[model samples]
Target: MTNETKIPNTRWWRILPATVLVYIVANIDRANISFAMAGGMMEDLGLDAVAIGMAIGIFFWGYLLLQVPGGHLAERKSAKHFIAAMIVIWGGCATICGFISTSFEFNVVRFILGIAEGGIFPAILVIISHWFPPAERARANSIFLLSFPLSAIISGPISGWLIATWGWREMFIIEGVASIALIFLWMPLIADRPSKAKWLSAEERNWIESELAAEAAAKKAAAATNKSATKTSYRELVFDINLWKMVAVYFLICCAFYVLSFWLPTIIKDILKADIGMVGWLSALPNIAAALGIVFFGRMADKSQNRRKYCIIPYVCVGLCIIASVFTASYSGWLSFAFLCLCGFFWLSGHPVLWTIVAETFQPEVAGGARGAINALGNLSGFFAPMLLGYMIQNYSRDAGMYIFAVLVFLAAVIVWSMPKNAETKAAVEKTREHVAATTNAHA
Candidate 1:
């Protein structure tokens, strides 16, 4: 766009493999508790549905509160440093959780894990914005995001194997040790930008800088024309109609997501009466489906440049699939599995849209804070989703819990659709195109 011609290289893809791999590890550690519960975790800990819900939901308690501050910090510091540090802290806490024999100790360790885990998403969002331009951001995000599904898919079987073979304690210990190893590996590999990385070619550096320079020029132009552009406070993002709408949409999605994370394995092992191995495998299926969905939809989002449609469509599909899942779970095994896969697929597709939209809405300077604010507020749903599902499951039936989930998903879909479509994004895109044309003409 800046008329800086540079050959595209494949070096960006290399960082992606390691980045996405650690991302997968992070999610796996976050999600492994669901699988652990299927083992003797619930029985030994003497946890009821409510207590279990609290345990899972508590991670978000600290996570929600720290998001904005973490975002601000991420903007100031290197994301690699933030991510590496948090990994160690959370991994250490997770390992200690394995040693906790009492419910109080378990809660304490989980709370610590929550605090350590809080900054990851916001930091990653900030990194994505810095690393890739709007044109490539969705695809880049999708690649890193591939870890979500991979984590989900792998967590069940891996945790199950560890739990069944070695014991659940060992699963935490092994995951923690692996996380520490990943931190060191990630250090030498990840850089804040291509310019900072010695391995990146000059062409690659120019390409990244050119993409960003165009964006900066556009923002400078906008700031000259609009008072809000020049004087807008980060806090104002909270009140902006579009930002709030996005937050509400994400809140609903988080509600559905955390519910599944907390309760899915338990439902399989307890309600469906599945064996431990079966529970692990079944739990992994939805995650695998979700992983596939992220890749497919993420690429599509980039190709089409239609973030809103991608965001809305998948959510509607997720709600429908959840409803179908509720009914199918009462039917044959194959039907149940099919519905879970469908539900997981659509549920997973919404994430790239969520983060990408935040990146698009704000300027790069405040993007981290914006992401943090959205995530912090939206994650409040994390507090309620699991606890509500737990209550429903305890008081009613698993069927009722699924019905409740379906309703929440539908509500989330509505919120996503209600977000005001900024014609500004399209305008910015057109301007970017025109600027590129002018620059090319001048260079020629």
Candidate 2:
């Protein structure tokens, strides 16, 4: 029997669901601020739009602190332990948001919250790399990333109802507490790698280890011949042009993404002239569309193994939809909402595929640090985008901010389409294709 046949696909059942749940709680904690702003936190705190924006944006500043260290620790020490500790820290900070009365207090808590949550993303990516081979990586990434939109889907209406019935403070406390409670499940279920996982059968564990070891050896061999691959040090990685290109691409994508995330509820409320509860439900529609699109496009990218095509296509679509939504907003609210859903569909779908490209470009030895650097730099947009949009909305018009996002997203597509394919990336892609083919033939 083939080794593939001997191994059960237990990683999917064991790992994906646990990680999804952890991230769901994490995202909800981070995003619940939007509902609070809409619900009356601004009035309660006596804060203006700019102040609120600062409060939201400050989180990213703190978020920048731990990303590289977190990823490195996850890779070198243990993803399972690092992530568990972060969950506790973020949960405590999230709960603290409930008791703050002033904008300054809110901003301080949010910053700490950002720092607490920042490392979780790259750490999770590191965990995913440990568990899944290249053949399944994109799909695995998409499934795990489902936490993004799924959190919005689940949180939107629920948070709305919680805020509507009990107020935003209660909503924050409840969700924060729930996030802390998740640590129990996380600790027991997660293992840093397959060999450490007690739940996997001996045969399954052996297969996973062998496949990963082979892939690692191939990468080592490729690095022997490639100068770019030889430069794995932090200083060397920071100076790498290809790494910065990815950073720029991710930064532009994030500029558009954070605007969509932080302002979508307000935009929906303005269009519908609806109550907070109705706005919550309406906001969820775009994310529902995003969830479906992520699943569809993730599978397509995996099947085709053309990461650049998938990433660029979705980016183009996202840009067009954002621009279209702006023009349509003045004519018809429902039409504008439809365009927003389209924007969400494309915006969120590209992320998993883009990360797949990152995984393929960097060897596992440096993957954690590389991912940390990219995510940290790219997520700086989380600070800039919301603050810029809020200023634009206050001084100029909402459409102006959206136009900027569209332009930035379009630029991201150009970068992805134009990025140079290096020897290491080419070799990785060829290896992945061969691995996928072998696995397929084995199953057949």
Top-lDDT candidate index: 2
Query: Judged by TM-score, which candidate is best?
Result: 2
| Candidate 2 stretches greater than 4 Å from native | 1-6, 224-227, 422-444
Question: Candidate 2 overall Cα lDDT vs. reference?
Answer: 0.86
Q: Distance from true position, residue 75, model 2, in Å?
A: 0.5
**lDDT score at residue 67, model 2, on the 0-100 scale:** 87
Candidate 2 at residue 127, lDDT? Answer: 90
Give a tens-digit lDDT track for model 2, residues 46-84: 978788789888999998998889889988999888889
Candidate 2 at 104: error in angstroms? 0.5
For 119-229, candidate 1 gives per-residue lDDT tens digits of: 888887776677777777887788888887788778888888888899988998898778777877888878877777888877677767766776655555655433233
How displaced is residue 21 in candidate 1, in Å?
A: 1.9
In order, the Cα lDDT scores of the candidates are 0.76, 0.86
lDDT of 2 at 426: 49
Which 10 residues in a row give candidate 2 its minimum summed lDDT? 420-429
